[model samples]
Target: MDKGMFWAVLAALLVFSLIVATVGGVRDAIVGYVMQTSLQHAQRDMAAAAVRQRAEAARQRAQEAARQREALQARTLAPDQQCVSGTVVTVRSNDASQLIRGGAPVRCSGRLAEVPLR
Candidate 1:
């Protein structure tokens, strides 16, 4: 081939190679950007899910505490029927004998037995 034609062919091949490389690089950059965005979205979703789970757990704990408090209140004896213990056994005014024994009010007769310490 003539010198002029050879030089022209070489320049054209170089330009084509450069264009191919640049296109490939741009495509790779686009793929990487998409992957990064997807990862970020996934992380955000996971964080939101964690927060929701914590909220649910806190709500459940609050409900359980309320139930326990209500149960404790229900177990408490009335003021008239309840009596303080000297030490050994604690008794509530359930009957006339128990009221006299516990030194509780006569209105508390036929009450249920309850022990605060135990």
Candidate 2:
């Protein structure tokens, strides 16, 4: 082959190699960026899930505590008498200058009754 032709072919091959290398590098960079973004999104989603779980757990605990409080109040206020009687009257008036009040005092008089154990 002629020397000039050989030189031309070598230069063409060099340029082609450079182009291929550059395109491959750009492709690798794009893939890496996409993978990184996906990973970040996954991490964010996981953190949000954890936060939701913790909030749900806290809500459940508060509900349980409230239920326990109500139960205790009920047990304390339960009537333990053979005969129990009480009167409660609530009065609400929207009149500007009128007073309203009338109710009998709560009273319990009876022999102690047996309470069953839980």
What are the clash counts of all predictions, listed in order?
Answer: 3, 0
What is the clash count of model 2? 0
Best-fitting candidate, scored by lDDT: 1
Question: Per-residue CA lDDT of candidate 2, range 1-118, in tens?
Answer: 9999999999999999999999999999999999999999999999999999999999999999998776555333233322334322223353222112243333322322122212
lDDT of 1 by residue, 1-118 (tens): 9999999999999999999999999999999999999999999999999999999999999999998776656445445444334222234455322333246532321233333321
Instruction: Show model 2 residue runs off by greater than 4 Å.
Output: 78-118
lDDT of each: 0.64, 0.60
- TM-score between model 1 and native: 0.65
For residue 34, model 1's alpha carbon misses the true position, in angstroms, by 1.0
Models 1 onward score TM values of 0.65, 0.64
